[model samples]
Target: MSFEELPHQADVRVRVRAEDCNVLFAEAARAMFSIMYVTCDEGEIERRVSVTSDDMQSLLIDFLSELLFVSEVDRVVFSSFDVVITGTSLTATARGEPFNPAKHLGGMEVKGVSYSGLTITRDGEGFCSEILFDV
Candidate 1:
């Protein structure tokens, strides 16, 4: 697996390309958000993940979904990304935070990152489980 950080307008863009799907998934998951058990090809296939209107959950979900959507829609697997977290919030084109895809293309379908096991610790970092569509 290989990873690189590409330049972007706003938000974080991670590009990852791995020979092993599992390892690729792990790296991508780690980059997108902190996670415990990276989903496997045999586990309960996750196709979508949602976030609450409040808190970091929204930003997290939006960020991961865009990756997956990009992978599905575009033929590119992101090996790295450029992340920009400002004032604990962001702005995007559509609903939720906006990200400029033209700047960073992490080609990978990431259905959604869930809030089920999400734990925003006091230190301001935590873990969560995300659902990937076809990965």
Candidate 2:
């Protein structure tokens, strides 16, 4: 799995590619969190999250949005994700510790995930999606 940041006029945009949908979702999580804050490899804390949407695009947005809410409320940033997608429902295990100002600071402040320019497609290289995070 891999992700890269794309230049944008405002906000942050990323394109994540993975071997499958499950991994794609997980990478998306990593991409979003990485953009928001710098975190260590020590994912000592774990959190389980579940979300459902009517479609794939909405599912991705909702999943990240929920994670963003949790991060803000609990003062944490997840470093890794194990995600499973069954139709429109998603269940994930997010692993990371509480926010450490020294480690988790100095990154973009993501306001929210945006649907604009959001696209998911499958090719021989597996699955890929471009997500826009509202900053």
Candidate 3:
């Protein structure tokens, strides 16, 4: 799985490519956290998250949104995800630790995931997704 930051006018955009749906979702989460400069070196906590949407794109948005909410409320940053996607539903175990200001450098504050320019499609034998984040 791999992801790269794309140029955006006011927000942050990321393009991700993976071997399948599950890896795509995991890579997207990593890209989002990377944008925020969040790193979980020594995981001290684990959270299970599940989300269902009408489609894969929506499911991805909801999944990431849940992570963002958890980060905000629990004051933690997740760096690893074991994501499973079946149809329009997603379930995953996220691992991370509490956000320590001294260790985790704060980057751009992502407000929410956006639907603009969002795309998820099959590319050859794998899958690719593009997401825009509101910063």
Candidate 4:
């Protein structure tokens, strides 16, 4: 699985590819948080996240949005994730550390995850999604 940043006029756009739903969500989270901070601190801090939605599209949005919220409130930056999706709900274990401005190189400030122009396509190979982050 992999994710890459795309050019957007007003926000950050990312294209993520994964072999399945689980990895797709995890990679998306990595991309989102990585955009905010390139690297976190030394100590590992674990956080469990759960999000529910009406559909796959909404599920993706909610999952990333929840991660963003958690990071903001806890004052941490996540580097890894183990995500599992059951039906329209997702449960994830996120690992990171407290934000250190002196060490972690910061990137753009992402405000929210956007639905406009978002698309997820699955063929015989795997899942590919384009997600827009409102910055």
**In candidate 2, what are the lDDT values of residues 4-49, reduced to their tens digit?**
9899998889999999999999999899888888554656888899
Reference-based TM-score, model 2: 0.95
TM-score of each: 0.39, 0.95, 0.94, 0.93
lDDT of 1 by residue, 1-135 (tens): 344444434323445554433343345544553221122222222223232335554555555566556534543333333333343343322111222355333434334555444333232132223333222
lDDT of 4 by residue, 55-111 (tens): 999999998988888988998889889999999999999999898778776577889
lDDT of 4: 0.88
Task: List the candidate 4 regions with Cα displacement exceeding 4 Å.
Answer: 40-43
Clashing pairs in 3: none
Best by TM-score: 2
RMSD, one per candidate, in order? 14.4, 1.2, 1.3, 1.6
List where candidate 2 sits over 4 angstroms from the true fold: none
Say which prediction, candidate 2 or candidate 3, comes out ahead on TM-score: 2
The RMSD (Cα, Å) of candidate 3 is 1.3
Where's the lowest-lDDT run of ten residues in candidate 4? Answer: 34-43
Which residue segments of model 3 deviate by more than 4 Å? none
lDDT tens digits, residue span 98-126, model 3: 88888888687889999999999998999
Please list the C-alpha lDDT of all candidates, in the order they appear: 0.39, 0.89, 0.89, 0.88
